[model samples]
Target: MPDPAYRPAAPGDGRRCPRCGHRVSRYNDARHCSPCAQALRREADSCPRVHESTWAEPEVQSAIAARDFGALCRLVRGHAQLRQEDLAELSGLSQAFLSMLEQGNRRLTNIDKIIDLVNGLGVPAQLAARMFGRPG
Candidate 1:
């Protein structure tokens, strides 16, 4: 017999997180529970190491040579297999800003922001130096 005070969570009330099967509130529309989502966000925030061979890629070289941050952002996102939200979190940029930058609606011209982006993406110092025409 079910207790009168016991009420099972209704479908619209909440759902179990797919990752950890933890109860997630309906108010939180994210795919995971708060804890799981936080963990995932933390993981995505870590700097991603770019492979040495990636620097040799024609697209990467061209973007770097042209100093097109929009193109570079797209390339890095693809190479790292990261979503805009993840990349934004890693690079200390907003997802909307990254989207605008990638679409050419915005340009990243601030040196400090550029440094944050490059460092967050784990670009090698030598490559970054070459890109910026600065001593490594």
Candidate 2:
């Protein structure tokens, strides 16, 4: 969490946590203080994902957003009411392949496969395409 403007963050902009040296990138980048900043800088390569909505920033943030592959897979199975096995049956792509695609290790190809899954979910193909980066 950078500033309201998404600044790259600076040392003085943070504070240190006595319990942990990690810098909390929240509350407009000024969230953490010094010592924490150092610790965070040292071990701060990971972050959490946002899951409140279907998807956000379909284009610019997707590779990173791809982190939500599991959730998307869940939504496809749960909301669309398609079982992993059933999806496997229909897509001609293995459950493990689907899992990998859902995990972001692989990507979706053959736009029609996406169309099939989206169809099962009852979501419009165009919107699904945007989320999957196959939008025309």
Top lDDT prediction, candidate number? 1
Tens-place lDDT digits, model 1, residues 63-90:
8767788998899778867788878877
Q: After superposition on all CA atoms, what RMSD does each candidate show versus the true structure? A: 11.0, 14.6
**Best-performing candidate as measured by TM-score:** 1
Error of 1 at 98 (Å): 0.4
User: Per-residue lDDT for 134 in model 1?
Assistant: 39
* Alpha-carbon runs more than 4 Å astray in model 2: 1-70, 80-82, 90-92, 129-136
Assess each prediction's global lDDT (C-alpha) against the native: 0.78, 0.53
Pairs clashing in candidate 2? 14-32, 14-33, 15-32, 15-33, 16-33
List the candidates' TM-scores in order.
0.59, 0.35
